[model samples]
Target: MKKLLAALVCSLPLVSALAVDVYDRDPDHTFAFFEFNHLGFSTQRERFDKVDATVTLDLENQVGSVEVSIDVRSISTGSSMFNQILLSDTFFDVEKFPVVTFKSTKLNFGKLDDVVSVEGELTIKGITHPLTLTVTQFKCAMHPMLRKSACGLNATGKLRRSEFNLGRFAPLISDQITLLVSMEALKR
Candidate 1:
């Protein structure tokens, strides 16, 4: 533990220096959607309409970080009945766990350009678990309409819903969940 502590202590300066670009999430452009198999017939998709997030990056260092907050009540499935079922105690239990969150712990860079993995802890249904988001597309420039420097990216990841206690139907409904996150942020 001492060596681990020493390593972390030594990395502080690098971390502090790498916080070059700070951004506020663009709600209109950001989306966090998920997919999972429903029974054996087909796949179901849902998304949370309300999400708040902040992202930062150090391009030269190939490092980045993200923090996100998702309003559980905002989860939508197009059908009101399905939405209500998802919010019930057997699923997300939105009344007891009103929010879902993710905060980065580390950044892993790929050898190829525009590819990096964000390691983070995700909390859902009041349970926290580790997750990684692989950035597939990344771009930054001035937004013509808003005239604000902005960055946008799409990331993908997978998780086991059972880990978060959202395994209502279990094997039948499929425990694995896939995530597709598209986020755009403006410089703060």
Candidate 2:
């Protein structure tokens, strides 16, 4: 009995160390951008102004998940008239669906125990569809200014706006949208 107790006590630190670490998204540093072709004249990009997320990482077990919420009403297009148009029934329909969300179903990890891609479900306009985000860059380190553990990543994904009921002009304004997520999370 004494030996069993001793062994269990000795492994406490190891168990705790392997536990998942939860991080809250730093809203000030996280944003979601969308890019699409505009009449084939040029590429147009816009971003959501409000994003919130919670991320969990288990480096020892090579598992993690992310849940992100974006305010659809906060779309910024650099033009007030265009922004309002996008908020109308043809685009985001912000009055009906005020938020878009992504919840991870799987986290694909690289050899370095880092997340390489995330398989998730994206919800928009009350419809959900499968989406995968490829992590282009990922880094986890002590934040120089915050003096806290932090993780940051740039991820890209693509989806057809028509699938989410956000397609208005189709090929003319572009139905395909490229998703770019620049996110930073702080350990909690």
Which model scores highest in lDDT? 2
Q: What TM-score quantifies how close candidate 1 is to the native fold?
A: 0.85
**Pairs of colliding residues, candidate 2:** none
Question: Can you write out model 1's per-residue Cα lDDT over 1-188, one digit (the tens) per residue?
Answer: 99999999999988878667899999998989999988889998889998899987776777777899999999889999999999999898988899999999987866653646788999998789999999888778899999999988898999999899987778998889999898999998
Tens digits of lDDT, candidate 2, 49-134: 89999999997788899999999888999999999999998788888999999999999999998889999999999999999999
- The C-alpha TM-scores of every prediction are 0.85, 0.93
C-alpha lDDT (0 to 100) for residue 1 of candidate 1: 100
Which pairs clash in model 1? none
RMSD of each: 6.6, 2.2
